[model samples]
Target: MKKFGIGQSAARFEDRRFLTGAGSYLDDENLPGQAVGVFLRSPYAHARLGGIDVSAALAGDGVFGVFTGPDLRAAGVGDLPCMADAPNADGSPCYKPPRPALAIGRVRHVGEPVALIVAETRARALDAAEAIFVEYDELPSVVETGAAMNGDAPRLWDEAPGNRCFDWYAGDAEAAAAALDGAAHRVELELVNNRLAPNSMEPRGAIASFEDGRLVLRVSCQGVHYIKRILLSGIFDCAEEDIRVICKDVGGGFGAKIFCYPEYVAALHAARTLGRPVKWVAERGESFLSDSHGRDHVTRLEAGFDNEFRFTGLRVSTIANLGSSLSPFSPFVATSAGVPMLSGCYRVPAAHVRVQGVFTNTAPVDAYRGAGRPEAIYAIERLMDFAGRRLGVSPGEFRRRNLIGAAEMPFRTVLGSTYDSGEFQQILDLALERSDRDGFESRRIAALQRGKLRGYGFASYIERCSGGAPEQARLIVGADGHIDLHIGTMSNGQGHETAFRQILCEYLEVDPERITVVQGDTDIIPRGGGTAGSRSVPVGGAAIAACARKLIRVAAGKAAELLEAAVEDIRFEAGRYHIAGTDRGLSFAEVAFRAAPQGGPAFDEIDEFAPGQATYPNGVHVVEVEIDRGTGVLDLVRYTVVDDFGQVINPDLLLGQVHGGIAQGLGQALLEDCHYDPQSGQLLTASFMDYAMPRADDCPDTDFSLRLAPCKTNPLGIKGAGEAGAIGAPPAIMNAVADALDADHIDMPATPRSIWKHLRKLAP
Candidate 1:
């Protein structure tokens, strides 16, 4: 492989600047004559709004302004729109209540923004916000998913009876039921998927200003163009070109920062009204209370197997908590985004799923890391392990019997997903080999002698990725010899700079240093799809590759003219264009300079890649754990994974993505849980002190390897790798815990205390 080429493990060039504290983030931005703003949040989970007394806050020293929901409403500002909605079983649109930028009449959850306080400094804004007092009449609240779905639960919206957003179902329920009824063996399990906070390194923030009658927003977000469109079409009724969004380096998003938050809209309105820049950055505590969360679902899964242990049918019923209100795309996350992967890597002929989105008095739950894919995979894999144990069969053998063989390419699943390619069994076998599955018996015996229980678990998972909007790329061979590559997908610390530059290197045959990646600017790039659903590489990178190929074709034509050779005779190699049989040639840079001579035609190419179908990235994860019976402490002794992510752009960057995802999966499986007070509806785990994030010691040294099975859906033949680790880790680890305890079933976040209680209950 060529150094710094597609498959090479090039060192991340952006890391040096990041490590040296030279990265620009939302909080790092400071504009001239900029004023700081803070939100005054509600203290009650559910309450009726009475009267707001913001007179004192508005009169505070150095206070620029104070804005409320009514004020915004009076200005003709629109509500924050929910971009996605699922249809009810009756085909009616789901109950979607208006979500204003600020609290309109009643506050549904604690920390709902009531007013925006703008001052000269952050401290002054905060102090002014504290002085704004509002009268509240507390109402009964429901926090749990199941409780919210109950008829007796407090009605969040009068339009949505029983606090239900939508009653949605996929696949043929009759077919799944018949398959299950005729099966030789069956098993069922019910569990909670647990809510979680995103907790990115930098909290969500934005800086907004008005320039030349246009609103300019600099925010920590996943996509700039997406934000601009949402602001114009959803919040502010302005022309598309009236707003420009620019995002620089974002610490992390994990799907939480993809939407148009009220702060962004309020800041823009404030800036336009005041004729000065307005900035708002969430504090750590504020982020916990307000940032979009993930994965709060109560699901009951039932599966049936034939006499030969082949998967006959799968049925799932889930109540997904949408939290206080619906965030953009939240409705689809638990429905279409995940329902398609209900069977995972198995070849189930019949499957059905019923998902009812419910509203609860808590932070809105949206996509995080693997989003709905993780929740779906966790259900199937855990059920597979449980069904195997019930049928007196090994987990590996059971999975092997039902795995979708490579020969079954382009298999149409019962849940509506058509998998293009995968080697599920081969990946599983590799993971088992790497984990020393055959030797597990001996290890278990040795551990038994030491008063420990050793168990091994397996999880085979797949997800539909690279299925979203098209991505655009524009390449400009600058007059200064630097190749500028522009794409719409913004990087939230996913190493896009390195991975994208590598793609350019393979086509341009130029040094990685000569390419500059420009993204997250709507003004610079006309359009983009932004980075979500792990589509950056498969979708955006493909666009870059296409653009580079176009550039090379154009350059070859220009090189032939400069070399005085026929275009057909021009051979491009190692960044040099030469005649077939002569030494007469020009370096790529030299040709670029000459092609775009001071007064000559400029060299640039624009391209877009819209994948015809989504790629299904599949993987298998095997975990071995030792549980100390005395204290119910579990140690993940070994963890192995083999994934088929199609074509990898940068091996080193791929590993980093996998490692980070595993750490998050580990946190969700063993430590992290976003809890709300059952009676008070208050967030219990609001800070790091209450919530347990996985430390380095918590994540095992993962034994990871790629089992290449190139996807056929995209031009580059690359599947998404961003969410794979998180999707597979949860079920593998949970199955291991179940094996150690010899329990029929258990929910996620198997903390030490919960395990100890389970053991004590089983003790003689």
Candidate 2:
């Protein structure tokens, strides 16, 4: 409750270095006697590898070492890990295939690494890699999820026949069916959630070296601890205790960097075998080919309603494409995080959800920003609009009528995820008000006169972060007045240093400049759950707050002793501890100075852990658009969001998160799409030229308003803000697009050409 407390807008201190180009990132890391590495990748999406001829490459100029799958096999290195072996609804383990560091006999994806070429320079490595020849017999591939999940589809792996990774279901299937069967009215709609590349500003890469029997990697990743553990224990034959992962300044992750890619393994293996540092940096084109994609869902949503228009039942069936093989947490991302959110903000006695995680010939698919939650919201919200059209009701009015309102505290859905807290109606009302729902008709008429079509859309989404994992933190206070905090969560682009510093400083009653936040270094921090699922602030901040409270208690006792008073008589205010009735007091700095030089240290170092239940952050997003009838180009005019994130740590930081999420979400709805050739499985969108990214002109200024309904589980009463905008924005935009055209459906990236076709088809 101090000046720089939870609600203050503290400028991010890390930005100073980033803005000035002083930040140290992985690509900037250089070690002595280091060699560069380049990969030889498969040209065919599905093929049987006949043989690999790397001898000529090893003998090339400046070449240090050449490695293939056989080399890694000979070196006793293990295959890549799946991380989570999720069980299907029937309690059978998901079909998991071996993810080798290098493709041996078969390549299921076009960009699968087949050879690693190491040389004196990066260019030399690249040059030498071209000399290596690989023979392949092309095989059939099923690129689309709809086909991949078919019973007779071309199998990607023997274990997962028909390419179905898992058959999962949640909620009461029988009850939902019965309700739908007896309903007075029902609506069903199907759509595709187009795939998206994470495309972090800095591409994924790593520099690996072995020194004194320890392996160290300087990488751009979301989690260093997991990478170290995963590499040492699962991939390489090295002691887990002898590994170090240092993630200095990661530009962004958006869930792609969370995977332990094959390139990391190849670099580490090559470094250890050659007894030199080896570095591998992915080019943007390579990133487009290999980075984990998100939201490739072929889904059908069926909502049941009574004559009165009250909700009766809801059912969703989705095919989530895992892409070639399972990334670490792909199954979990498509199921637990994805399906439970299908209910959104509605109350239904019966609901059923089924997700068939299917594998295809493409880069692996996993968490991206809002992950499964966004895909779920997009389906339900779009269907809500479709149902509104069916019943001749306004989207806003229908949503308000059926929303699980404020009185429903801790509402447990049929999917079994307990909503911690939410005010869905309040959020929707505020969003509609801010977006001028009442004036939309007039605006539409005005736009019609100008040969433009105007429309309004709404999406209400719920996000569950803080995935029941305990976060760790260690606080160290030096006698010189330096307060350092080591947390387990990596920043990955979020303002962790500034936000955590503000939270700690508020408790210690210290200046913001007094604290230094260190993260993503396994050698420095004992344990952590690196940032994903928007868990950093909610779970990580709770850990820091818990430890801070304990530290304050210790500091108060020490202050009481120093002031010759009982602990109860000591009052700590404005960074100083004073005896109740007198002015005798000692500052925190003085206490640290006195206690450190003496027997007991003034600093309290405690490792704080879990406040486990997931926090639900739900929101309503309104998007207004202007469509050019002549050219078929759509212009986003206004976007307004009202969310319940429980509490705000830094309003500016939260707003930035919302803005970035909206931009990425809008990118998916209007610009970006990761495409693979349906027949050949060749990745068509493999570079910036083919893969469209949203620019400044593509996004409208976003207005964000927070409706506080503090979460009951976490210590800070704060839910996540990281993914709210992305989860809610896409459906709103697409719904508006559908509205303007008076169409039942329009898939994502509602590109100008697609719009032109839709408009043309409807023209009379």
Candidate 3:
């Protein structure tokens, strides 16, 4: 138990089945009398639905149903869900457009579901969908964020004119403007946070069945209870208790699989009508066109500095592209969570922020990886470097001077977010030391001799994590010998089994091998928020520890009765309860075995059901790059990261999370970009062949360290590490690329083509 305890680096117990290819993903499931479901997609981005030809597919063999939007509506199905509309500063509700499962009168985006074709086989479903065609009257499409916000832009929703959902503001505008008006120095930069596909290893899929008025859902997603809630309460308008959800071994989510899609709801309807199970799986191409995208933003930032070289004020105006329709948490991602990230780890007192959530003809945008924090950090960190260039100061030194010092614990920002705890300067110091910043000048000279341009960049990021609505955990010490823990948070390949087991071992003094962790099932656990925003460890694990503690207390009482000793005189140590004055003790398993036959099962339960604020996980990253001036290719020579993720649960698992997150961030910085044709509103980067993803060869060995700064809110003293790497990586790499080119700025995905163009402009 000691070797597999909290600080120990225990391997994931769930990896055995995964390695042997025995994992049970949604696609692996084959239910009784199951049929495959496929959707007919719109070819044009904006078009009127004029369809009357479904007889051909309906007459075909093995076609259970060819349900269109109107057919589904006639069957009493509800529209897809949206975020609860919030009031603006002027006391008006945010515009919310109806999101139907299938297209009715009009299709807003190219991949909008138009019809459902259910057949005995997937091939038949595909064939039937192709046979059923709908006539389209193509209309002008608004493809770009800027174009969508134009005064004369084509409207995507009648309720949201000019494609604007909400014009939201944070902080004090007058204070920021006045400070800028009298500042000693000021800088403004316009930038774009490129759109990205989540690209989870397995494309999204779902299986749904309705029997005896109970709807059962199985999906490869980040949550199980969340799926059940959406289906019962939001879509079908049924009682919440009539639905069961199971998520067994999801390949990866990265925030993409958190919402309820049209196919899922339609599958449930198909099951009810056909009286059998209906399954749907997205092809890789379909996933590219349909899945929620991330970080499509065009922002303008103004930063003001005083005569003493201190940051005085800041202002930001961001036009966030929400694509054709709003997802469940899209509004929060584009504005609510994004605005507070503007200041990052720095102390910016006077700041004002405005976000315009716009609609474009593409897949809906929502949380991906770091979600809103990455976009905000990229803007603020880039602005810091941009200001440094103007003032003839090094980026690192400029950031060091402005970081929120350790003395300012629990500091509140102008945008209204409290940073619980951080050692910002300590992280930068560790990162600089690890990256060898003092000798960077010598390396620059060495690179010049080799005819390459070399430069270093810095990024410090802070993100809110680990506060979900509520999580539940139940611990049962059974009659036999083994113990079981049913938790609420679902794992999207984050090693929740190993990490949670570690927490249980440390808290209850139980053998790690004897405890089994179960998650992602709605029937086993009553209610859960479902995992996203890095809430698994801090919130979910804390719930486990609380339950274990309660179990220990109950067991101590039982042990006191068996040993003929007072409850106060019993001391528990390493799964054994001892009489305090003597060596006589009883094992926990023995106590459970005796207690169960006498009264009931030995168990404890806890709920993280109270309201709380998010825990902050902060970090610093330093990257050095060498660019080939002739070919404009860049080689990442060295990358170093230092994070303050509170106390470590399992070092190995957390390190793996850091590595994976950095790779995704680097992919966005140097390779990945989602492209939509401006004129035609068609997705150009629809597959891996066209879209760039970072490979193993593209990555360098990551150097990582930690400076412990335990969170004050959570009882376990553990913050989150899930999204830290993605939050800090993009800005660091982009800043290095710009530094190498000796330019003020450059856009993301610094491909050789873009780098070559920038280098050519510097010629002569």
Candidate 4:
């Protein structure tokens, strides 16, 4: 690979500024005469609001205003919108309750914002917020996903019977039932995908100002346009042009910051009323309570196998927790986002999945890193291990027997997902080889000598990249031999600056230094489908490639005129244009300068690209673990992965994404769990002292490689790699742990205590 071009490990352009403390994050941005705002949150999990007295807070020193839910409603502020649409299995509309900017008649969860206090400083805002008194009649709360549907469970919404939001059905349910009934063997397991807080390095925050009857919001979000649309249409009921959203640099947003929060709405309302910029940033504790969480599902998985041990059918029924209310993409994540992937990398002749979205007294749950794909893969992979154990077959061999083959080029699963291109068996074989599968016995014996139990596990997963949205890219070729590229997708530490420039270098044949990447501003970029679903490189880069083609075509016409040759006779190569069979030519800079005497861009073009279908990124993960029998301490000994990501942009950044994802996945498998007190609904893991993030030592050195199988559906022949590592790591680690313990099954966040308890049951 050439340096500073596609496939090369080029250094990130934005890191220099970030490392030098010059990155302007949301908290770092401030306007003149800005006031600070703090939300007064509800202390009870579920309560009826009788009255709110904000008179004392408004009279306090430096307190500009204190607003409640009634004030917002009186000002014509609309309810927060839920953007998901999934009808119930019986074809009825999904039950959707109104969610206001602040608590109105009732508070369903602890930390629900009840009032906003704006003052001269953060300290003053906090002090004023403390003075507000609220009367509440507490009600019983349901905290667990499985228990939300109990007959005696407390009801969060009167309209939703049994606290069920939507009971969705996907795939061929009748066929799946028939296949399972006819199968010779069957295995079942009940699984729990633990809830997790996003924990982005920079907590969620927003700065909003109202000037001249217009709203300006500076938020740390994935996309400015998304925020603008939600606030204008969903919350404020203002015209599109009435709001301007700006996001320069974000510390991190793994899907948590993608939605419009009530804090943003309150700040905008306060700024308009006080005639000053109002800013609100969550404390670490506030983030634990307020930020949307991920992956709380209680699933019952049943797999049917034939006499020959081939998978015949799969049935999955899950209770997906939607927290106290619906977030933007909560229903979609629980249903369509994950249901199609239940078939995994195998050829299941029949499959059916029913996900019931349930409400509970906790924070709203929505998209995380892998979103629904990780939860789906974890369930199927764990079921694979369980089925293999019951049939007395090695997990690896059983997976091989059912694995989809390379010959099936456009294989469509029974669940309706079509794999564009993959070599599942080959990837699995490569993972096994790289992990030294044959030598595992020796390693197991060595561990046993030290009073440890060693085991090996495998997880083969296929993910449907949510790149269906169109992305826009605008390119400006300057007269000074430089290019400015503005794109729609924003980077939350995924290195869009380096990777997109590499795409430009490949097409324009220009030096990387000559190109500048611009993103995250709605005013500048016009329209974009902000970064999520691993679509930045696959969909956004493809748009850049299309825009580059248009720029080249238009530039060629100008080059033909400059060369005094017929348009068909002109040939362009390496940033130069020449007449066919002649050496006479003009450089790109010369042509650009000639076209624009005022020294501006010679060519400006914008292109929008949407792939014909979503790309499928498939891979195999193999993990080896050693456990201390006496203490139930597990150590990840070796981790190996073989992925087919279609095309490579920057190998270094790709590795970084995989490494970070694995760290988070490892945390979910062994350490991280968002716990709430069942009786009180108080968040137990409200700080780092209680929440266990995976340390550096928790993740082992990974043996990673890629099997290049360019996607057929995407124009750039690339697939999404953003969420692949997180989708594969958890189940592989859990399977290895189960093998070491000689157990049939276990749930997630297999902490030391849980592992010890399981081991003690086996010792007797």
Candidate 5:
């Protein structure tokens, strides 16, 4: 591989515009004569809708439209369809509740959109929205996941009795039971992976315009093509081609923007009815209420281990809180995203996992950064540490003993996942070396002198990306000698433009600047599965490379014809096509010119690279923390991560992704939680003042390295790196805290109060 531009830490090309405040996000876009829409949300978690008196709101000055559920229903709009579906263990279909764009006869959760008030100005629409009267007969609501599964709790969905969406389990149960019965030592722990708000810098927004019998939607979404299909076929009952979904410069998605929100439907409907563009931008509070929250699972785990600290079997029964109506991807999240990755990087001989997707009176829980992998990592790694203490083995040594070895290539776990490739011990060794695990006792002693507890934590985690499905790309070499590559995957902050450009430049041997990457426009790009599950590089990047190769072939053939040489005799290298034993050659630009007839190139090609299966990216993370015993305030001093992402496309962007993911994971481990009052269903932490997001000062200096275990699945050998940091960081941080206090257990968000309470319990 060339060294100049392919693998180096090139500074991001998009950062200059973003840092200078010149980036154009959806909210920054303003159409001529655009009206603002403010949604009227339900305050009660469960309530019967008696009636909505919109007369006063309609009388408000500058109010153009007030749309409710009945209006949408009358307009022939259908409920948003769940994009992902999975069967139960018994082969029965999973329970899927109808998710209406606007609340129909009942409101199942707080902040459920009931009506949209469109006016000439944002403030006016908000004022009109406040004036709308909604009469509701409040019903008993269940906010807790466990309680929701009980018979006493009021049912949120009749189809799913006891509010249980599915009783799904993975792995061999009988074998796992037998292993547990014969194990030398057993350990059990109850854990909670707390719910979290994505809280991307820019809130969700949508601008809709209808003209010439066509609907154009510009929104802050991760999947524009997917959203177009959903809106046209599901929501508006229009043809997919009749609607164009354009996501222009999204601020950040982090899995929150991957779903179809009610605001989008409302904005589009308002524009169609009013014959003018309508815009709706969610406020910070609205974003907190509406955007999908992630990782609310109450799990009880039991692990069986032998005398040598080898894991024998594991059992986990978890209640996943899928709030109110199902989010677009809720079913898949519970079944596939949350369940498939239960076995982390360990070689457990047997395992059984029963995940019950339950309905609660709260915001819907969906994929966050690491999605299910983080929760699974927390459970397995915490149990590993606990087992280590019980077995009198060091945490690092215990992990090394049980980690899936390199010889276990194409290893299939009891949990039904075939890990294509990994070197789990290598990453752990690298992480330990980077963190200097041997010198940790001295650091703990130094911290103890200052009345602090210092400890280190380790986690070996694995994740599968590029698993969702196939992705498509279209690339063409234009007459101007520049290549235009169009892909269906949209970029939120992963630097797709720069990363994909590098792939194209490497394959085509063209200058990076000559390749123009286009994305997020449904009209231009072909069919594709949008970016999530860290599938962009292995799936989408491969698709882009496939297209580039096709373009090179076409260009080479044209050059052969122009040079009057046999196609096989012509060789293309470094953007030039030459004949064997001849100095006569044609530059890429000259070849493109020769291919062009009176108007343009003779042929334009598109390539769809379909991958067989997902690639597994595994890693180990070591976190060191200092706890102030007096104040119970924990400080993350250092975080070291060694990941096996198969191969590196861009080291700088990959590191940035790792850093950002660690921030989110650390927030979940020590700082962030979405708290709601059980009685009122009122959100306790709705703003930044209450929700503690990790800032620059909150994060420690990170040490990161990649273990080069190239995946054999993809052509580029790149596994997913987007979610690895989040998956590994949580366990590492939690383990470090537990090690610091020498405590047996600590809940997530190890808030100061929780830590203080644990300390009190531990003290004599």
Candidate 6:
């Protein structure tokens, strides 16, 4: 077999179906006897459910069943379980709120599911849902992160006091304070990472059925096995083996479709009670209210620098607004996701971070494209720019002086993370070169002549991926020389089929066309972690490689037997096994034919590759922006990204991931914000008309490239590339806007009103 070196640009193999509109999305599936399920949700953010009268809906013409909270509880259903269980700073366990599948005595947030109505069609289900009446006693709500922590706010849970879910701290506070006191210069700023919705092109949908004493479910999810475990064992009070889950071709997930939602459990329970299939599809409006939102952190940051612009210390206190009910991964997002990566790619001598996860009256917040890393990068990079302004230094020079050098491989940080490998300076240099930093003054002058204010900004970011315990894979050789590979990782439009096929072909010396990759089914690939935390390529791909190697070993033995040669003398290459000293060789197909009729040399192998640690992938992004000083509108002019994703397996796919991530990151920084009315708690930005999404015209031409460092932790020599763009994009664009305005502070989504207000304040 030949080695497929790092940084090779192989075209994506999944584009054919996607471009042809043949992608098999969950909504496209129509079971023979499927009934549509619609949800009746709460209108008020906080309210006591006085009564629910589903009798009218149950007796309607097309209504098959109407399930409420009481029905779910009567059938022995449990609340959804939170994944992470981190402790607070005072050594007490973090608050664990019971997230019931259906609203119990009270509803905590608007759009909280209260009842499920099943009918023959989607329209009928929706009509019946609206017909069901419910009475509520409205209660005061808290929608702001800082306000939620105030004593006047209403408590959302008894387990959590003062509406505080968790008060967590990382790094050495005393050392950070001491360094700050003795620093030559210091700067402080306040930032808000606004809330964003993961509007995957296709909204979430599910189809569930009960047959032959087992429950079968199909969803558009990133983690099919995890959903099965949560529903069958945790919530449904059934044996894990009795439930089967499958995720077909998903349009997109972006970390929003990774969990078990209430509708999923309701559909399955409805199927069990009615003895038929029940299907549910969230409309765009319902999706905006139900899908897990991202970011929403209010932070105060202070940065200390020496005389030479070297970063000395940093301090950050963030209040994370995790909506009314805790999302599955909220704890990890607030503490592990953002807090650990606060330093980004810089080498700060000392740093301290405190995160208070607070409850808000909105949709639950979880992982989006970048998850917590975007919030961290926004804070650190913005502070870096402010520090540079205070010290009268260029942003580039200040960052270059403080970035982690290439010599610091496997460097451990004060926050307790071991960066496996990265060349931080190399990326920064590449980004700067690609962005044409030297000629930016001319561009700004040109823009100024057109009555536009032009500015340039740069952000260097580092993130953790391929973390968690382990992943498993199974490799099987069929009778006709076809290869079947099974893994536990699910792909929701990340091109796992194409990229994984390349790895299997490179390792097994088999034709890519003959290899088949299957995933997102619990019954098929049992005992493996589902994909998240960007662990698929590095961790999951490594497991596949290990399984392929074992299969090759077994095939080599069979080839040796057929060729009348010693097993030690046989060498397999180019799909054939040859003897070392003789001109005798056997093709893999021929060897398989000879070994078959006797189980084919036990041609089945399973591998559980556990690295037991996470690898950090870092990069640098430079962006140029043109701000209309009069109108206060910012438009992107040029964007360049140089990322070090360790070794890239498929260059084309890696770049695609980077491009999509950057667009999302840019959206969060400038346009997209999930807004709610402070007084009424009504979601104001509900549709495309109100919500701002990045269109083709909105994104500037992008220049993207990769640098290779080859992480030593995984056998594939690859790190995760799923979320790097989102992590690094926001800070770069925001910093560029701040540079153009010459302003002391600016919030995200710098709308015209906000920018004009800042400009007016700067006026004499």
- Writing each residue's lDDT as its tens digit, candidate 1 over 538-588 gives 999999999988888988998889888889999888889999988888898
Local distance difference test values of all predictions, in order = 0.90, 0.87, 0.87, 0.90, 0.85, 0.85
Error of 4 at 661 (Å): 0.8
* Per-residue accuracy of model 3 over 577-647 as CA lDDT, tens digit each: 99997999988888878777645556555545332888899888899999998999899999999898998
Model 4 is weakest, by summed lDDT over 10 consecutive residues, at: 1-10
**Candidate 4: tens digits of C-alpha lDDT, residues 311-338:** 8888899999999999989999998898
lDDT of 5 at 10: 63
lDDT by residue for model 2 (695-736), tens: 988879888788899999877888998988889889999999
Q: Estimate each model's TM-score.
A: 0.98, 0.98, 0.98, 0.99, 0.98, 0.97
Residue 180's lDDT within candidate 3 is 91
Determine which window of 10 residues in candidate 3 has minimal summed lDDT: 602-611
User: What C-alpha lDDT, on a 0 to 100 scale, does residue 411 get in candidate 5?
Assistant: 89
Could you arrange the candidates by lDDT from highest to lowest? Answer: 4, 1, 2, 3, 6, 5
Model 2 TM-score, all chains together: 0.98
What's the distance in Å from true for residue 242, model 5? 1.2
* Model 1 worst lDDT run, 10 consecutive residues: 595-604
Candidate with better lDDT, 4 vs 5: 4
